[model samples]
Target: MRLQTGANNQDKEEIKKIAEWILTVGEGTAEGNNDGATEIEIPNDVLIKSEKNHVKSIVSAIFPSIVEHLNDKGYFEDKAILVPTNEEVDSINEYVLSKIKADEHTHFSSDSVCQSEFIDEFEQALYAPEILNGFKVSGIPNHKLVLKEGVPVMLLRNIDQSNGLCNGTRLRITRLGKHVIEAEVISGNNIGYKTYIPRMKLIPSDKRIPFRFHRRQFPLVVYFAMTINKSQGQSLSTVGLYLQRPVFTHGQLYVAISRVKSKKGLKVLICDKDGKPKNTTTNVVYKEVLQKMKEDTTF
Candidate 1:
């Protein structure tokens, strides 16, 4: 049985465009003038998306060789942005922080002030700290902020969409502060532009929790390695896709591979049963979804 994944309105629009493109191109029809025939120009966004997918496929094919070359040049760990599963984010972050002595620079402790009109002081004492500490241990905005200048970070909220300070936006910390931080946009159109990020109150949606609790913290995380879901919609100069376990969802492998700007910046490391480096990986694609897209052109 095939699972149905819901597509957003934008996705449906893109599908319609692709279907029309396919129908127009596959039928071998061209708009003709009196003197000559003119071929349809593909949309710039479509061309860029196609080019990125092509580069990703090529990079995935030669990932091992790319990893070897990167290691030889001593550019794997320090420079490249590592993308891994959520389970591995903490371990990798800890390893990278320790290697760089991130603690020596500056540490910003998140102010976890309990703010709720419903809960009293005694009740707040029981759930607020416990829940907030749990979030910290689980790497939700992190407990202790050990930041070093020039380290990569991922924005946790959509602070400014116009300036490209959105969720999952990658940046390098330029200056640390008590109430704010100066960071330069490392990816997207706003690259090299510096912006200020301030600590804000963030509330988690956990249905199991009986009381409401909000944690005041900077909406940023040390992104030495991030989850594939969080790495979506952002392209990196270099990507190291470290697979401790095989990806279990559709489009995850595709998302991870397509994060790099070029084939030269991509590397994949798969771990075997013994947790050693393996050369092969399993890629899961729901073929039925593609078939559905081809069958349904009404979008």
Candidate 2:
């Protein structure tokens, strides 16, 4: 389903900025050997949070489109769609469901299903393999390892080049001391002619599972616990960071604040006059959260 947007021009600007940032323009030259590999200790807490948030974001962004297409074809309100069981999810299941717009509106479930399932049903499409010639697609895009036998490697994917179509995707991963892999890249098709990610690091999460998508609306409650000290190194475009002295750390606060690309990307929660952590969290969106609170509380 096509998203009718009155703010096409505005969205184009935002998209352009996002693309540019991802491309890493004006970034430095590529560094280190082409073949490198190392294992870094995964911070259990950080991985848990990052993976969860990353997956949920991807799912929310992609699922709506799938649902919209399905609804347009009269799939919404259909009874044949499988409803995942609680048992299936706990022991051997990791399925999730949320309301979405297919063409009109519907519910989509991610249970006992593989990426191929979505593709088979035309719910989603993969980037043409040919377009990703230089990169390998032996497994799912994120599944393949970037290094082989302690050698650095690349993962290429099709990306929108500011100039025109690129030949392929190339992401360089080099081994650093302490079992770390520093990300670097050389690509003619997309952003950054040569960029050395000196501090870029990857810490595998438990099970080495890649992030998956989750689609849920706000007022939406997720059943997971969150802690602060676990977050470090990584940055986020948007985040709602919570802090409470003893349980929280300065390092976490710093990382959380830096994750956002700009001031518009952060939200902070502070205690109130009553000395209680007064649910005073605010997002650094275009509008102020305090104004929203006033409006929300006025009635």
Candidate 3:
């Protein structure tokens, strides 16, 4: 944010050469009239590494030895690896989970296709338990949620309001029980707050799927890494921008880079089609949306 203008004097000329991408670093791209915001070089203060293996680079630089220091609030707090897609997020989380030298706890969800005209007994028969278990719908936990104690997860539903348990609320796993999970809130108004989460019936609102199904499972998702769009309201002190694929949506790159408190705390690794790291990546911006927003805010 301090370097929004991209202005540098002769004294700082040498430092300016280090930046390769002109990033519009500020309060996450929404605070001001960013009608046509553009940039070329990101400042050299942050660690910008170009590695072929982005997940490996991300883990090594951002969340190294996560199991050893899971109790450390600083380890998980205000620090995250940012990616382009939920698939990447899941893979990164699984990779991190695979490294933990602890007992594994796999929670299986009871998935059933709701009785409806859209799906009959024969169709339902096709959606076997194992087949339904393989389905990963948006905005719900997976059929087989494998977790370990001391892992971090985000609440997918508003379990409790007064207790600060809501959607997007982060929690650190304390005890992975057979029925319930014991976790402490690690972010928002409930930091260090202890609570229990029970299995709940969750139904996805994806209307495209003709048959409605309900998944009974813990309303949680691993928070080791999240998609760029999910990181909008989040403020992290240190962020590793893992561009496994370049962002496709409007302002995604802006939103991704702006998650960190400062450019100094941000690290970016841009990758090409072959997963080779590069210096520059695409930044999609909708000028019409920005212009409309500016017009709306004018009054």
Candidate 4:
């Protein structure tokens, strides 16, 4: 299911636009070599959405990857301004009512819109949006991409960078032996001009003590949710997207559907009023890529 921030996010028209933008802009280019062309297109008719359930597994793993890639690529170049509909207004009212119930000290009238507006005003007062673009995503590349028992698992380590600071390092769990797995750290933390490693004697699967820093040493692990806006700049090998109208922007629909390397790699779930995949627009670009891939791979 797609992530919704506020009640207004359930709009379908807006979701389609955002999805389109993602399809075109998110998967536009890549870092490595594979014909340094400006853009690439996959075949049409790849069955991006099926009547049956064939894309379940691939969807589970790919959504996170797609989100990370987009953040790396700087998809959130512009701000999204969302206007609420009547349905959204009602939702906000319901939410406000619930909040009022939770805090018995505050009294609220039956007017849902008034309560909702008051809550929105209070929340909006906290932080405004920051304008950002073209920032490299660190830490992700440090994690190793390896397989354990035929299942791929990304292994990461928390390493101490001098002066009470620690950065998590990562390695792939390559070959699992009786006690350890053969692995190597792909990336390490950089402090000032020097780079450091797990030089104190370490092996894969070894449970080491956490580094201490200034009475608190290591940096806390932080997780951030991926928004459709930030995901516009990535090129995903495979993608599973949730569509809703509330987060819509012009070209956003295009962005969401076109991230996959091929149509076969794309899976989309369109949520209805009941929060199920009952209402969804057919992804045109996904179909196009699928058709092309089949013809090329055909013997």
Candidate 5:
């Protein structure tokens, strides 16, 4: 379900261009060249680059002097740097975190392997506490969480839906305490509302995993930047698509570009496999899947 139009977003011709290419590619008509490859054209004006150092350039363009604007909810509300992979997301977050010189506080979690009748002691022994601590499961926080005051972190679980502390909620750290972390909601209806986040026991929700385990940790992740997969269904005013490497999955390139509501708020950075400057990137679309769906839907 793609967004045809976004409320409060004026004039989405830029979005239309991106969406059209995605549709063309998805519908199996974009490969007009003899080489059997499709390269979506990104507008020159929106092709963001200032000489070298592309990551810093995009980060600066999205977040300028973030240290000083920690108090401003609007600063992090509409702005985000989106990456294609988790490694890039972590790199950008670290780079942004280094820019802030505030003292850091670390929060470590307790990890344990859940006892399942299907699993044996040998399997359980393999997943030691140290090994469990290092596990990076989707929708779960890390074993060690380092945070500072006024930085944005996203909620990974639905602690309170009525109060708007749901999954993917963004909040800025207002105060750090021994037992709890104080933060103000930066996204959704509860924006500017302050709340306390408590440590909770969470299990791996990712289906790709073979075993079940629990980790007692804060359900949060630093939101300076996020991966494209995680950014799905998130609406933002300004978004920087930091595609150091091109997207590898079907509709990912489309999802990344379509996140921004308005034409003026979207900026994309694309490069080749060698990491050189480039204006175009491959767009993956499974026309066979679309055809299969069409056949299934036929009356």
Candidate 6:
């Protein structure tokens, strides 16, 4: 499969070298091997990075065009807005739900059984909202739930991968029940097909917290917006990347930009700390990882 990007000269050269090395290694024939290895070639324009302010410009210049394309394809009927963190996901979900006039918000109920008797009051207090907020800042499977028919959502677990109901799979709610939700796959091979999602017990682990707690809830979240990390393995038809904060980790910016199948389907909004538009964007790439790959040519 060919992966394209809009990267600058430096990044393009580095990516090209990496892609060439991968092709060479994969197609190299082993000693005493009778069968010839399958040859794979990397496309010349496989990796491209958007120029500085390119994404912002595209979003501004073609906002209406992109919206028209989405509307024509019925993408807006079901879509995923990719963000950078869980907190942002929750915040955006709340905002979208509020705007749509959906008021039903379900909070997860935790199991009260204590696992460790050694847990003191201080350690137990870590699970409280005031304390847990500090730790739950970046975890998975959100504790709060909001359901609205026709809203897009993402599965948090692998209920059935072969059937396209897996982690990061996007779906639109067809029916919402107290114990189960019926949804139609909107972005996978099973698009237009429906599936049933049931409430399940979820345990979140954070090193900052001393004790663990289990919360029982549906394994899904409003995918109107989701963290970029959670969107790694999924292909989105229409992607709105809201960068309220600059991405801090390596490959985050790349991953976020590359989620959409094409540039026409992408819309990026980069905001400053004060939520205003910003001209420049920050990209974090660890060059050492590339150096290591170059040094280890034996593979």
Q: Please, what are the lDDT tens digits per residue for candidate 3 over residues 153-200?
A: 989999889989988888889999999999989888769889989999
Ranking by lDDT: 5, 3, 6, 1, 4, 2
lDDT string for model 6 (234-259, tens) is: 66655677676777776666676566
Report residue 224 deviation for candidate 5 (angstroms): 1.3
Candidate 3: what lDDT?
A: 0.75
Q: Per-residue lDDT tens digits of candidate 2, residues 84-118?
A: 12121121112212332112211221222233323
Sort the predicted structures by TM-score, highest score first: 5, 3, 6, 1, 4, 2
Number of the predicted model whose TM-score against the real structure is largest: 5
Candidate 5 lDDT, 1-299, residue by residue in tens = 23355433554555567667545655546655211236767778778874678888988888888778977878898678888777787788878888888889889999887766266678767877998898877678778888889899999999889999999999999999878989999899989888999999999888887778899988889988998899987988788987778888777776777777666678888777677778877777676666678999996
- Which regions in candidate 2 have their CA more than 4 angstroms from the true location? 1-230, 243-246, 270-299
Q: Model 5 — TM-score against the truth?
A: 0.87
- State in Å the error of residue 11, model 5: 4.8
TM-score of each: 0.63, 0.21, 0.84, 0.28, 0.87, 0.68
Model 1, residue 171: displacement in angstroms? 1.8
Error of 3 at 148 (Å): 0.7
What TM-score does candidate 2 reach?
Answer: 0.21
lDDT of each: 0.57, 0.27, 0.75, 0.31, 0.80, 0.59
Quality of model 6 by C-alpha lDDT = 0.59
Root-mean-square deviation (CA) per prediction: 13.2, 22.5, 5.2, 20.6, 3.2, 10.0
Candidate 1 CA-lDDT value:
0.57
Best by lDDT: 5
Model 2 per-residue lDDT at 191 = 30
Off by over 4 Å in 1: 1-84, 101-126, 136-140, 205-211, 292-297
